[model samples]
Target: MDEQPGLSEQYRRVSAWPLFIALGLPIAEIGVLFGLVPIAIGGLLLFVGSIAGIVQESGYVERPWNLLAGLGGALVVLGAALALSQLPGFSPGAVLAALGSNGLVVRGVSIVVAGVIALGVGGAARFVEQEPI
Candidate 1:
């Protein structure tokens, strides 16, 4: 690439926004879960992150932001799992009786699956970014 100038650099900057935001994910989570900030901000971050991941060149494929997103998302799901284990609706033995009785098992399983998938995707993205262009 020979530096196309103007639009190219602009796009590059735009592309980097997600990487920047990924680094700031903790703040975004805090704003949404703890600070009680506007959902709009959180929603915007999620939307931009998704779009940036898809459209931008992301340098290669090993994008750190993508990896972080996947890992961080998985961690979020894991935390939920730990918290759910304590809830009266479910336990190691049974989910208020049986895993299927309350039907929470399905949802829990889905969340864990989603988390794993996210982690895989994020790791792949990071790999792409780190690879030789």
Candidate 2:
């Protein structure tokens, strides 16, 4: 039997990125709704963060949930159109118009808060030795 101290820290750091996305997803979605220029980039980040969170050992924390939420948001903003485009050969600019914007301050704030909390939890988790408690 063996335990690795670095494992928890690694997971915590990896997970933090997802929380950042979750925080940003709302803003990105809003941008999509507003027809802004940065929406696509924001949406891209959401997708990347979600995919990463889904695959990585982020542990059960805000980041993992955030990733899932971000993915859901991406779908809400443009999933159906993409599917329709494949079927009838139709396209809408909504797919490319959902991303970061000046109004994303709210999302940025949430992401920072979630990140701080997750870091604390992950840090605390690391300090707790893997043993019966």
Candidate 3:
């Protein structure tokens, strides 16, 4: 009988965050280019969440909530810009029209939605505490 030696020690540990992040970016790009709102939003969320996970795993930050919140804020602003820039005017009618038929507006809204989720998750994580009794 023979047994494997040093198998445990030689085993390599890998993180999935980097891979998901890589995949997410391209998916997001494709979605944006093709005007696919759901794809764009899903990709953005996956990418942003992966980043936070990677940062936390790397020990660079004690908590990823802050980073998530920051990324979310940036996304919110960027999305707002994209959504607003398409508008010809600030009138409610114009807004409705753009929202109904504009791809850019749709993408922007998707981004904003992802951002808000990230922000809320991040902010809410801050308040979570685990106590061992």
* Residue 84 lDDT (model 3): 87
RMSD in Å for all candidates = 9.1, 14.6, 4.7
Q: In terms of TM-score, which candidate is stronger, 1 or 2? A: 1
lDDT of each: 0.49, 0.45, 0.83
**TM-scores vs. true structure, each candidate:** 0.36, 0.32, 0.81
Superposition TM-score, candidate 2 onto the true structure: 0.32
lDDT of 1 by residue, 50-124 (tens): 544644455445344664465547545763574476466645565434434433443444344444555655666
Write the residue-wise lDDT of candidate 2 on 1-133 in tens digits: 1488667765634345567667666765665455452554455455445554655554445334444444445443453433343343333353223223323332333333333434444445545646643
lDDT of 3 at 60: 92
Off by over 4 Å in 2: 1-14, 59-133
lDDT of 1 at 51: 47
Residue-level lDDT for 29 in candidate 2? 63
TM-score for candidate 3: 0.81
> Which candidate do you rate higher for lDDT, 2 or 3?
3
